[model samples]
Target chain A: GESVGLHLPTLSVQEGDNSIINCAYSNSASDYFIWYKQESGKGPQFIIDIRSNMDKRQGQRVTVLLNKTVKHLSLQIAATQPGDSAVYFCAENTGSWGKLQFGAGTQVVVTP
Target chain B: EPEVTQTPSHQVTQMGQEVILRCVPISNHLYFYWYRQILGQKVEFLVSFYNNEISEKSEIFDDQFSVERPDGSNFTLKIRSTKLEDSAMYFCASTRTGVNYGYTFGSGTRLTVV
Candidate 1:
């Protein structure tokens, strides 16, 4: 079975510092990947995404790096802030299947 | 900006009872989906709908579960007989196109089966 997993379940960083969250996916057929931020009481919000053909994509203060060869993905947040504290999930879309598979999620905390 | 919206933020039902979770996806979006997350677990995909029909679904979406776009704006998921194991947060999402495009997800409905 195909699975997407994170390297860390929780990560803590200081405000103004950079934060990195890593994810590994096992499905080679996955063509698209997305990063979502979820607050305690809200649904997941899309942050950034990358296609298999591209190695990286950047959003406001977020960047997503994809290594198709290693089947790895990472989300980098520049100048982390308290508002950036949330559970982040990486999702992969296997082209063969239309459904998007989500990882268990990584909890990110930013302290001042 | 327009976003997905779900009704009945919370639901509680006894075992063997039926429950329907409703969602209203963004008007311009063409794809609709349902996903669930058990307490402390990963979010799992249940089903995807497009063009008034089901395009894909996961094994978790078994015979007990069914999805329908009964009206122009409403997408509903009905569980024939709820069970304890069915308790989870159900999220509804919509995308302008397919999987290549990111989706907009609703706040989700918490279903509790007692």
Candidate 2:
């Protein structure tokens, strides 16, 4: 099945640096995208979301960029902190009824 | 902030035993969903419920699995005759409209079938 995928399985970033996670989705029909952060033993926490009509959206310290032409999405975290160390997933909603297809997560390791 | 709540943080059950996972979605949300993630895998949608009925379900949600909103507040997933493959982290989520509105996920219940 055509699915969402990440470019990197793991990302190492120094604390206080900027971190970027990239994802590629194959389903062109997908119109909604979201970024979530999952810590150990916890549920996925919503970070940011972007609709296909928009190219970019921003939250507290996170930004989601969507490129419909390339079927790509990216999440950027500014001033990465140790608390940001977690597995990040990119999910796309292909249907209006709303079932999300999640990508293999990118493990972000924030190093002090 | 309103959030989804799940009960039984973890469960250990023998194969062929029945298990029920419970969840309390946000009070005002209209849509409910169940998703599962196996070890080292991405989250997979199991089922979606609306208006006290199942709106959609995935292939993994076979005859052994069922969902119900028996009362007005509690949504439950019952797995009959569990198998080892049924062991996974099950997460409950709710949204006001749909995924476009961003779903709030519960901490999840980890089920282990032996």
Candidate 3:
């Protein structure tokens, strides 16, 4: 079955340090990828998205990298803060459809 | 700042009972969808509605599940007969025209079946 998965279930980072979270998806035909942040008991908040044609996209302090060759995706957070601690999810969209298939969340814990 | 709003933040229902999760999607948004997150699990897509009809749905959206944009702004998901496994957090989301527009999700309605 086609699915997306995270390489790490939890990542610990010191405040002000850079953080990188990785995800690998099985669907090679997917055209768009998005990264989302979900606080406890809250819905997913969109962070940044990258199209397949673009290898990287930046927003605010977040950057999304897509490696189509390996079907891998990564999100980089600069100056990680305690407020940035939340479960992060990566999702893929196919053929201009908004039906998002989400990967298991990666829990990010930042300590000051 | 527009938002998708869901009602009954939490609902406790008995097994075999019917439950309805309601949402008010962002006005002017054309696509509406329902997704569910079981405890400690990834979010799963259920169905997508456009132009008052279902454009797509997942296998998880079986005969027991249905969606409707009964009125102008309200969209709803109904579970005909709830089961224990049906207990999960239901999230409603919507996006304007293009697929580039990622969905904006509502907080969610946590359904507990006993």
TM-score of each: 0.94, 0.95, 0.96
Error of 1 at B103 (Å): 1.3
As a whole number from 0 to 100, the lDDT of residue B23 in candidate 2 is 99
lDDT of 3 by residue, B30-49 (tens): 99999999877788989888
Question: For chain B alone, what TM-score does every candidate structure achieve against the true structure?
Answer: 0.97, 0.98, 0.97
DockQ of each: 0.57, 0.55, 0.53
Candidate 2: pairs in clash: none
Q: What is the C-alpha RMSD of each candidate to the true structure, in Å?
A: 2.2, 2.1, 2.0
lDDT (tens digit, per residue) of candidate 1 on A1-112: 5444534388999999999999888789888899999988678898998889999888899999999889999999999999999999999996443588888789999999
Name the better of 1 and 2 by lDDT. Answer: 2
What candidate 3 gets wrong by more than 4 Å, as runs, is: A1-8
- Ranked by lDDT, the better of candidates 1 and 3 is 3
Residue lDDT tens for model 2, B1-114: 888999999999999999999999999899999999887788888998988888888899999999999888999999999999999999999999988775999999999999
Report the C-alpha lDDT of model 3 over A1-112, residue by residue, as the tens digit.
6434534389999999999999987689998899999998999999999989999999999999999999999999999999999999998985354888888889999998
TM-score of chain A considered alone, across all candidate predictions: 0.89, 0.91, 0.91
